[model samples]
Target: MMEVPRDLFIPPDALEVFLDTFQGPLDLLLYLIRKHNLEVLDIPMAELTRQYMAYVEIMRANQLELAAEYLLMTALLIEIKSRMLLPRPIIRTNEDDLDPRAELMRRLLEYEQMKLAAQRLNDIPQVERDFTLVQVLIEQTVAKRLPEVNVDDLRNAWITLVVRAQVNRHHRVTRAELSVRSHMSRIMRDLRGREFIEFNELFGPSAGVAEVVVTFLALLELVKESLVEISQSQPIGIIYVKSTDFLTSV
Candidate 1:
């Protein structure tokens, strides 16, 4: 077994410390180029490759396994550097030959743009990170509703009242004299000065059915004689009685 030397285990340089934090080889390369203000279009491949290998050596010394992507990028940089060092064939042409660094520059530019966009997205307010979920207690009112009644319900109620009235009614027999002529005279006296009287006002609730019938007959007789007139605007409207003498005066 061979033992490694103590000098070989030296810590990475301060410049290479930032390399560990980079996302990928391109990110580290971009950082190095930008730090030195080197033009990406005209990169000094020799210096860039030296710095890249230094970081890689440090990673390997630290026993940190290098990613396949980073190793692949390192090989590409070495190949480009070698190609640049080789002698070129002289040829005259209208169009200029493509630069070896053009592809790398394009990739670097695209990676930089994507990185900036990622940073911007990360800076935006996140639901769980920047803010916490809030719960609110609210009071609400519940309404009490009453049952609805239809026309049939009202008719049933009326029938119940009629039945209850009949059950509570008292039977009595007495000889009470009532005359249509007397009722007519009394109605005429009431209408002497009045302009109009409602037909219902002529018969009160206290008046029995017999009295109401006689009063109604007396009203009809008065209308027949032209002494009183009953006027109603609509078929179901209230009937109003007016004496002919009172009408003539108006």
Candidate 2:
């Protein structure tokens, strides 16, 4: 008797197969109807609705989140079923009788068509190509001697630094985020009278350690942009600055 009981044991997780795949109760019902090649307009609501609730029970057994939409769709199906079961006076005419489920059928057909179209589109190849119309042309104008550094040149470099730092990977806490542009503007205002200053001294203690580090990076970018020049006195000494060959075009 004991051996027979052990031998007769059934697999525990057989119901998990159904629960894992269903989007919701409605999706399961729709799938079952389609699999059986049943017309949506003539849905045997009593049978289909029972099957839907069974799928929901399976979902509940698996402790999955039961969305309210599933329950709502079930109620709608039941209502449509009750409406279909009612008696109505037959009108003798050439025009065909209207279906109660016509609206639901139309929606289903449209949705199925869209789904098939999307699948077909996904099969097409994707190609990458540079698509741009506007070309950047650098015009060589008549050489007219002007001041070494303009007010706007330094301002734009500061703007670029702030934008880059905000988007940089190293940033974490927003509270810890310091604006390099804010400090740069302050430094520029302070260095208005002096034409050149030592790079490290320019980023001195008024700005915190993090701000100083970002400012150094900003200076490098400014140099690369030809907005400023960096010069060293010896092998490893303080760097000097001179106005660049090109002023900010932007």
Model 2's TM-score against the true structure: 0.38
- Runs in model 1 with CA error above 4 Å? 1-20, 92-96, 142-250
Clashing pairs in 2: none
> For each candidate, what TM-score against the reference?
0.48, 0.38
Weakest ten-residue segment in model 1 by summed lDDT: 1-10
Q: Which lDDT tens digits does candidate 1 get at residues 79-174?
A: 989888877668735433666778998999999999999999999999889998898978765532222324354344334444544554447866
Deviation of model 2 at 9, angstroms: 23
Residue 162 deviation, candidate 1, in Å? 39
- Looking at model 2, residue 206 earns an lDDT score of 44
TM-score of 1: 0.48
Per-model CA lDDT versus the true structure: 0.73, 0.59
lDDT of 2 at 91: 67
